[model samples]
Target: MADFVKGLFGGQQPAKVAIPGDDDFADYAGAPEPTPAAISSYTDAAHLAQPTGALTARPYTAWYRVWERTSPEDFKLEMYILPFLFVLILVHVWGTRANRSKAKAWSKAHAPLLQQEFAQVGFREGEATSDDILREKKADEYSTYATGRQNVAFIDFKITLIKRFNPFMLLGEYLIPLFFESIPAPAERVEATAYVFDGNEAKHAPQYGSGDAKKVSNSSFDGFVFAIVHKDIMKRMREDRYDISLTTTRDHAKLPVWTAVMSESAEITDMMLTPELIKAIHDAGDSFEALIVTDQPIDQPKTLDDTKPKKRINLSLKLESTYTATLPLFQLFLRLPDHLATAAHFRPEALRRIKQTRDEQISKIRKLDDDEKAEERKVAADKQKRELRDQKLGRLSAEEQRKFLEKERERDSKKKMKRSTVKG
Candidate 1:
């Protein structure tokens, strides 16, 4: 007890630690090295300690591997992502169906009213047409409008009940809901040739086709112009927020009746909608109305050389302008009584004169085309002749070759002139 107390207080302690020369350390040195058989057994035991199910698997399958490694959080995230996408797809499809239904209902209600209007104007519905018919009509309208011919005073109205959507393009709509909303809306287009009529039904009988075909061509010659624009355009015009311009053609012979912006409130009378004016509309190219909303007056200072200031002058008061053409004016012309009145002044001689001029212009165009082609052929022939002359010139002097080429050119020019005069 006394010795233990002394050791606790930093006195001499008992020798429990082993030194290097001790019996315990010498006994570990006498132990033999492991034999080859023992080493092999140890290695096999280590290999056996690893999992057998991992190496000799139940099956080589992705499902098993994923099942083993997939975390709870990963599974939860996948559940969230899938439902989100599914809901988005459902919303898009539902919206599209609703739009289509709405458009169909709108068309059903409006078509009857439109048909009645056409009937009042002596335009009978010829036939129900398909997409093919629409394409052909569009092509024909383009050609007639471009050429200012082959068009007659018949109104063609088309209503598309439903518009189809592209699946892939529609998927992108979700990225921008407001801007990319797809609506299978009903749409309508009306095309008519405004012409002059002398009111002689027999004399101005349909010249193009007969029956259903006749209705498709120059059947109606009531001498009134009509245009029912797109709904969007009508809305813009109603609001007085559309771009409109009226400019003459490059030749300055034709004047535009209307351009981009059309108004139902234009004060122009039906008498103004003449055949000549309608022809101008057919010939006018696309143009925009530029409006200067407001302009301020300012003072200008005049200077005299470097000596002194001369005088202060008042600049001209600037003007603010806005341009628009209204549909009411056009719509008025479509009325039956107004139409008949407008046609009262038109003479059959006027129609004959217009057609004659158109025919003569077309003939000139054909002749010009032929002359251009002939000139191309002559140029090619001249090139070949020059090649042959070059080969022959190897035996002649420079002066002789030059003279021969000059004579050849003169002969070709004379021949071209003779041909042109004969054709003319």
Candidate 2:
């Protein structure tokens, strides 16, 4: 009892009794030894007691710390990329605003001149409010100019002020200058006007050259203004399909040296360029680019079936200023079609020849179109045949597929044999 009390109070230890065959207990054990306590689920009490500083830390400061640890090359790349993107955005914004301001100013300046010519003078297609102009952000929308319609005989008159600050042109204009100063920067803006009118009675397309006499004569002729006729007409001319040439030389003595004509014949050229008209052209000075009378489409046709294009008289001019001095030239251009109808009429013989040439050209084009359609139909039929064969093969067994292929081969052989016999 004394020993038990001492042990309970933790002052004395109890001795263990020795058992016989203790080493042999493992041999007698039926169950496997219990697994050590799993470390995966274990947690330290000390660690749990420690403070977590994440809640009080600043996010931006943490991010900065991560960036500070980046490699030198990576840091340099980041610096360059960030600044470039910022500059690009700034340039785009500035350019857009500059273009808009210039367009608005031009519209205001030209409003009076346009109002005088037309009953309705407004933005392209129809009238637009200040809000509408501000909202237009696209490059194409900016390119389109102000228009005037509801004139006496004219279809529409347009005045376009080309944008000076173009983001697309920035690379060539600004960056290229740094490397090669010798390369001159092209003109940024062009103030141009176009007067359009129907010329249904025009027998043949006629184009006249403009600008300084020496320059006009010496410069190589290219562009739509020079070639008023269709590609078909040009092609035929190249092939020597006609007896007369398309180029009709003007009388330099009677007309200005700058006035060069490309027409169907001398008769049409003579009729088109009268003394009064020549005087008007001469007065217009170097501002004139071309006076085109064409029956061909200005824009490309959407389909092959759209063969017949409308006839029109197109007068292009470069206006240096918003001054009303060029108003008389505009007036003369407007009355040109009327003048042609009343004062100048083509002889019956000349009209007959022009009509005949046009009809022949149309016939040839139609034939080519019919041939293309035939080829398309043939290709479509072949495609359908292939699809049907594929479907039939997909449904068939392996043996049936082999039999079908053999039959096809036999049919093809028979066709070849029949062709050879016919040729013999």
Candidate 3:
């Protein structure tokens, strides 16, 4: 329309201009279409068959390849097996917990029976009363932990009834030592007797132990007779000191046959019985009998006051029957069967607990002994070193003395370092 308007107004006609790139399109449009064979020749078959970088497997996609490799049969099998395995693990855990609970309950139920067994022996559970005393160094916290701590002492308050003294042994050499051994033996003999049996009965004859045994000894009497008294009465005996002495009578009708001063020892009061005194009593038609006398007078408590004056308890250790006399050796064997019978009834768990407590007590006593021994050794070593130093100083000149002092200081420092290393 613009071109017609321009022609009427005497303007020249506008021509259509062609795009610069349309020449190739006009040529191609006039050309014939290519055949299928020609197109196939231009295409690369290998390039299409081979994987491209974009289509190639990657490290991150390795799991997908693994999934593809798995058989459908294996996947079906796992589906049925996995749940059973999970249930098995749960059952195992539950079974373990149930067993633990059952064991704990059983232990709680039988603990009291085990304690009763301990009482059968001389061990009773209670606080320190007037009857029992604990004479050992202990930590302040120990008292607060348990009342049974006080009753841990080996000695029971009541005197255990020993079998009647054998008339045969009274004439034997063994009787001499019973009184003589009461007086401390020679150092060699005492040391030799440290471990009497070492738990071996066949090699060493059954005899009383000395040094090491004394540390963990729980028996009130030495030799064949080991008497265990009741807990209640033992408590009363510890409240006060009483004189226990052996006396012999010239005649059965005579009064105050034997007389001796009472000397106190570890828990029990003792007096030396001379052979001459024993003979005098035997001549008195008393059959060499020893009478035990205690100054503990018996008195009744009029009031129920806790602050009441202390009363001396009249205690007695009497023979059951003078007629049924047995040798000490035979008496020892007789007690063995009684011990066995008592032990046979104890449950395994209770026995284990008893052994554990006994071991703990032994360990504590042993530790205290070791500490005391160490202190004694240290004191002796210091004295020895001091004496040696004095002798060396007396021989040395001023210059030599100075050097000796320096060397001693170095030696002492090294010794201290060695001790610390050992402790660590």
Candidate 4:
């Protein structure tokens, strides 16, 4: 008990008392060499000491090797690494290809889907389409609308579609939901052309086709030949909360009949059912069943009013300003109507004249360039001809050499045609 109490207070103090007086001093003074640590073999020793077994004195008959199996996390890490490495390769190869990659397939598929959705529920049911998107912009600044769609490509190996501006693009970019009735899938596009119309009517048409890209030859006319596929644009309007209102411009002289017909058209159709038309007649409460809208609201609820002078004046200050700004072009378009009607009838002659004008311009530029080069060569050749005269060889002037080259070119062209026929 005394020893136990001493050991607890100051660890094994008794070991010092057991040491011999001389040997204790020697042991403390002498230093021992550091032995190397044994490497772990995991193999069982001769008298096998199994981790989960009782110790045995008999020698081991066969070696028991322990295999360190891979953990669940190791497999998961490999799974993550392989796909990440594969996708990295695809992006480097596919993104910068000279031609657009297969991502266009999604563009082709989604364009029609968005088109159909926008076409449906787009405008008022019975309204005239003359006032399309452009007119709606004026009615109310707060009015939300489906604009247009654009397609763009971004890097990061992620080729997903993003929709902007137009809601149809949203449908077009991503896939349209399948619940909508089965419309045909959108078709593929082969080519697209921009109708590049500058002020020069003579050089209006420049056709691009499957030819030398750097120098495209002109076709008969400039018409964009994009993929000609059929897609539907549909819309459904809300029968409720619709009102018919007319905003008019008083200047009959300034307004074209077509423009006037379309100007107030969108608002007229914005809500076909006015507030008065949607009467609360439901027996179950203020719910609506049938609605009524009088053409004109008068002193009486049911009666149509015609006497009031409600002359709406849509101001022409801005419109007139724009016309005054481009009065010359506006007059040209006005005068163009009569000639345009005639132009449709004589398209072939117009095309020929336009072509002739373009060819003439190009030929003039070429002639000027060739003339400058010819003059420089002429000065050099005159010196050479004087040298040739000094020599004894039978001499011809530079002009004669030019004539000879032209004759040879013509002869070679004919001979080439003859050889092609023989080969055929």
What value of lDDT does candidate 4 attain over all alpha carbons?
Answer: 0.31
Using TM-score as the measure, name the better of candidate 2 and candidate 4: 2
Top lDDT: which candidate number? 2
Clashing pairs in 1: 263-325, 263-326, 263-327, 264-327
* 10 residues in a row with least lDDT, candidate 2: 217-226
lDDT of 1: 0.37
Clashes of 2: 0
Stretches off by above 4 angstroms in model 1 are: 1-68, 75-84, 114-269, 272-371, 374-378, 390-424
Model 2 lDDT tens row, 1-424: 9878876676544444546778667554443456887765567886677678865777665556866776677678789899988887787677667656655554555555555555445444455443232224453123333333321223443334333335667556666757874553443332233433233112221222223322321211111111122222233332341222424433445555654555665567666666766776677666655566554444433344543544456565554555344446556665554554454456777666666655665677778888899999999999999999999999999999999999999999999999999999
Question: What are the RMSDs of all candidates, in order?
Answer: 21.7, 13.6, 26.1, 28.3
Show pairs that collide, candidate 2. Answer: none
- Candidate 1 structure quality by residue, lDDT tens digits, 1-424: 9988885676764535555568767656544467675456447765778787778767666776886777788788789999988876776676556544443443343344333444222222352212112222221121111111122233333322212233444444344455633432223222332332233233444543355443432222322112222333333332342111111111112334343222111222233445643443443222112111101111211211211111111101111121112122223323433334333244556335434533454566567668888999999999999898778978778899888879989999999999999999
Each prediction's total of clashing residue pairs, residues at least 3 apart in sequence or on different chains, is 4, 0, 7, 12
Name the weakest run of 10 consecutive residues (lDDT summed) in model 3.
Answer: 186-195
- Which stretches of model 3 miss by more than 4 angstroms? 1-234, 237-345, 398-424
